[model samples]
Target: MHYQITLAREVFCEGVGLHSGKPATVKILPAPENTGIVFIRTDLTDRPRIEAVAENVTTTLRATTISKGNIRIFTIEHLLSALHVYGVDNCYIEVNGEEPPVQDGCSAYFFAVLQKAGKKIQNKFRKEVVIDKIYRIDDGERFIIALPYDKFRISFTSLNEHPLIGTQYADFIVTEDVYAKDIAPARTIAYEKEIKHLQDMGLGLGGSLENVIVYNDAGWINKLRFNDELVRHKILDVIGDLRLTGGIVKGHFIAVKSGHQLNTELAKEIRQGGC
Candidate 1:
């Protein structure tokens, strides 16, 4: 039987948030069994602790944000994705700002942190959710296809208006080693035209060529980590958002032109007491 697990020791890091663009230091600590993943906002007076669950997700614009009453944390998908890959069942994540640092716009940094901190098995059996049927969700231009499987897997197809990024695809069966090599290093990407629009919406304030892959007709503004990185990044975000289901989801999720909103909705649908 698989046991629940958490970090063996504390891990600390700091950087600029992808959304708020504010500075933040995160302290990740081990938690007891059944605690789930919780984010504590140390900057607030009340020090609100928000749970990472589909219902608590407050925003899904370019990233996922979870809130509880007066406090909210932004751009947490990357860290969550790392936790999922490592099979971390419980953790206490404390942050000093409103959003998590978006290092290189990928899950690699978080994976390193968790890897360094190590894993400690808890005394309780880890909970798992097995898909019992086909679950589908669509938002007009995009949709998700979730099918019963014995592993957490994904196949993503991304279509963009950019000439160089006309069509891209990614597929994976998630595991610690597999994810770290195949998906964790893929950086978040955006088109050249969306910069001004995103900035106007008060998003991507800390964005730069150093952290995000900015593409246009000219091609990768910062060079390529993977030629099909755009689609792989989409799968990374999907992996992150789906972790909000609070356990491992045994299924193959096929997403097309989907973002955080659709990802969280699919998690929400399956989480309404499972398949």
Candidate 2:
């Protein structure tokens, strides 16, 4: 590919952080080719720059990405996912506080704002880190594997372990059209018990019925877009976490109950020539 793209103009959104309970504002600005996606902590006086890279990953408590040169931002997966699928080659995301807004706990808001701004293609060719072999990592029962493939692909399996979630399997061929329609609207879900625990820990401060699916021991309070929505969300997360590699990836991912920690580790492995 001889072209790279960025937003045509700036876009803005504001909301509270699900974990921090603090309000935040995010602004997206188009960047030149080779700039990549970077997060600027404008709330700080020094204004630290945090590259969305696996090496910068500091935490993965409830969601992915907590990189910082000084202060940290929490829960950046959904916004990052939107950027990845939308093929945003380079951009500067300035957050007035830690954490991007958990708008609806999905990528829909980011997509809408990005679509409205349109995209500008640059002259430089884009680059991708291709997987050349099978590389795997595991944490307890969770595991993620990257196998050689030409186009990006993902397969996921999740067992909610509750009567409500059961076990789910989902697969997708990664592409913009498929992501926009099939994956972008799927919201993050949580068990009521977990939500309570998160709240007790002073986390998930911004979680609500409107932004997240609340599942009880019995079943979901609402319906899901797909039968395997839980697994599909896991796939969406992998796409976002892998973007920390600083470019596109050409590989097939086989994930079994894998979370951000494992996904980030796999990206590091790939960069180290382990895959």
Candidate 3:
């Protein structure tokens, strides 16, 4: 049987929040079976807890945000992506600020932290969502679909107006080794024209060439890590956002020009249909 898993011990990391531009430390701690992934807002007076789930998702702007009452955590997709890869079901993510640190705008650092913490198996069986039929979400120009499969898999097609990033695609089967190697290194990205608008809107305040890839008229502002980094990052995002359905996804996800909004919608639909 596939057992549930959590960290063997707590691990801590700190860095800059992509949007808040503030430094925050995140503590990943193990929890009892069935605890799920809970985020603690230690910065708040009452230290409110927000469970990581689609229903709690408050915003799908540049990144994903989950809220409970007044407490909200921003830019959580990267961290969640790492946790999903590790099969981390029961854990506490204690954040001392409004957001977790953006580690190189990818999940590589987070994956390393998990490796350091190690994994502890719980007696409880894992909660796996097996899709028996096709579930789909579609917008005018974007769409996401989950088809029946015996294991978790994903294929993403990215299309942008920019010539440098017009079309890119990535396909992968879910595994911790595969994710840490292939997905975690794909950084979040933005275009040259959007930088100023993002700053004026009070977003991406801490972003730099250090943490985010800036695409311009010519090409990527910095050296390329993966030729199709944009599309790989899209797959990373969908995996992170789909963690709401209890981690184990036993279906093939097909996404086309979809972002956080459509990903969350597809996840919600899958949950409602008994996954």
Candidate 4:
């Protein structure tokens, strides 16, 4: 039987936050079995620990997670995605700012950290929420649905407005090799127009041509690893968001133009103890 796991030792890294534009440091430490994923704000006047769960999600505007008292940590999807794929059941994350550093704008860095720190299996059996029936919700053009499946699978279709990223679809089954080799390194991307708009809204302040794929009418200023990287990134995002279930999920999820909002909504619906 599968068991809960945590890192064997603490790992540390630093990078710039995708949204806050602030340089931050993070320490990923092991936690006892069943402790779940918790975020501690080490830089705040009061050190507050924020549990990583759907209910504590305070913001989704361009990738942000906050606790009940407004304590937050941003740009956590990549790291969260990595943890879910690796089957790590619990962790203690300490950050020195409001957001996690966007190291290379992908989970590659975090994956490396986990590799170096290693993992220790706990005695408790890992808990999982197996989907019993279809659960779905939609908002305008965006939607998501979950159906019963033995393995975690994600399928996404994105209608990107940028010329370089028109329409694309990507599919993946959650596995260590699949996630680390296929999805973890797939960098986050944004259109040139969206970059300026986000900056105007005081977001994506740390965004640069180096951290993300910038597209324009002429095409990407840099090379793309996959033709449908936009869609794969969406799949990556949804994987991390659905992890808000606070346990391994056994199901298949289908999505179209879905973001954090729809992702968490579906999790909330399931948490209400419904089918």
Regarding lDDT, does 1 or 2 come out ahead? Answer: 1
Provide the clash count, candidate 3: 0
1 versus 3: better TM-score goes to:
3
Residue 100, model 4, lDDT: 87
Cα error of candidate 4 at position 275, Å: 8.5
Q: What's the lDDT for residue 196 in model 2?
A: 77
Against the reference, the lDDT scores of all candidates come to: 0.89, 0.84, 0.89, 0.84
Per-residue lDDT over 1-275 for candidate 4, one digit per residue giving the tens place of the 0 to 100 score: 68899999999989898888999899999999999888899998788998888888877887847575656677778888888887778999999998888888778788888888898999999878789899987998899999999899998889866665678988888788888888888888877767778998989898887779888777788888877777777888887887788887889999999998899888778766543
lDDT of 2 by residue, 74-158 (tens): 7888888889878888999999988898888788788888888889999998887778888999877999999888888999998
Q: Model 3 misses residue 1 by how many Å?
A: 2.9
Clashes of 2: 0
| TM-score list, all predictions | 0.97, 0.95, 0.98, 0.96
How does candidate 3 fare on TM-score? 0.98
Q: Candidate 3's residue-wise lDDT over 64-94, tens digit each?
A: 8999887789889899888988889899999
What tens-digit string does per-residue lDDT give for candidate 1 at 1-275?
Answer: 68899999999989899877888789999998999999998898888899999999888888898988767898999999998888888999999989988988999999988999999988999888677898888978999988988888999999977778889988898888889998999999888888899989999999988899987777677889988988888998998898899886678999999999999998898899555
Candidate that beats the other on TM-score, 1 or 2, i.e. the better one: 1
- Point to the candidate with the largest lDDT: 3
- In the predicted model 2, the residue pairs found to clash are none
RMSD of each: 1.1, 1.6, 1.0, 1.4
